[model samples]
Target: MPASQYADMFCVEVWPENAPAWNLFEALQTQWRAGSGGVIGLDYGVLAEELRVREIPPADHEQLRADVRVMEAAALQEIYAETEK
Candidate 1:
């Protein structure tokens, strides 16, 4: 799948305004793509804590959590389809 599709799975909004947090998220994405476990290690709690430390607004943080759920569901579905095949 295209990289944009991966991004779409997680985030519908533009990049976060906080540069450091955005950078961290990008690094995490790199790790995510390299790993076989899909979203296994990419827990929402970790992400939310990082964003909280960066002082991201609560509303935006909640949106990120929702986005992660969307992404995790898509990843799980893809894994299931692949295994079935």
Candidate 2:
């Protein structure tokens, strides 16, 4: 896909332990959809529902989480550096 396809993309990671965070997520989703006239692309519900039916093998779960953590950290660091510039 072209890079522009993801220009407005946003990602969130929520573990079972942080289930309450979904309330905030839902609120953001509502606000974004409303402000953008429902043109913000795919909603989190799409991914959430996909995750509901998909099962990750126990062996790979930790590694997947760790990889996501690393990527998220890097992205945040990049953003911080950019802001400091």
Candidate 3:
């Protein structure tokens, strides 16, 4: 299956090296669970914040953001195709 199809099925955690970032995702997931709606999207803003808090290098942050954008675009395209089917 495509990454977009399972994007919301599970959250990715780049652990050990980025444990704090993973923890941030866990916290956000907890807050999301309290709401009525299921997790259908990601909060990149919060992720960026967490990365900053974790003192991730700027170069690494840019690379991570770029990777995420690629995945998000692919996921959106997949969803659009599904809707058109």
Candidate 4:
């Protein structure tokens, strides 16, 4: 089943390798126990903040951002197609 079917709210965490981001997020959302998968969207604002916090070098950040944009565009296209259907 989709996560949205189980949980009313979602907390997406993007963090460094050392950080227990998922565990921490799950702890906060203890009311609704949901497993992760079938993500239809990317929170780019949160992504940017994570990249900044991780101190990703400007050059690498640009490259990563470009890659993420491509992914976000594809996800949007798929979502639009589903809606059109």
Off-target runs (Cα >4 Å) in candidate 4 are 2-43
Report the candidate with higher lDDT, 1 versus 4.
1
- Candidate 2 per-residue lDDT over residues 27-56, each given as its tens digit: 333322223332323244543443344554
In candidate 3, the residue pairs with backbone N, CA or C atoms under 3 Å apart (3 or more residues apart, or in different chains) clash, namely none
For 32-61, candidate 4 gives per-residue lDDT tens digits of 222363444555566666667767676766
List model 3 lDDT by residue over 1-85, tens digit each: 9998888787665758555434555544432211343335567767777678878787777766655555555655775578679
* lDDT of residue 85 for candidate 3: 97
In candidate 4 the C-alpha lDDT for residue 9 amounts to 65
Q: Sum up the clashes in candidate 2.
A: 0
TM-score of 4: 0.47
lDDT of 1 by residue, 1-85 (tens): 9998987898645445544444445544633432564444455556766676777687676655656556556766786688779
> Residue 18 in model 3: shift from native, Å?
14
TM-score of each: 0.47, 0.40, 0.45, 0.47
In order, what lDDT does every prediction score? 0.59, 0.45, 0.59, 0.53
C-alpha RMSD (angstroms) for model 2 = 11.3
Alpha-carbon lDDT of model 2: 0.45
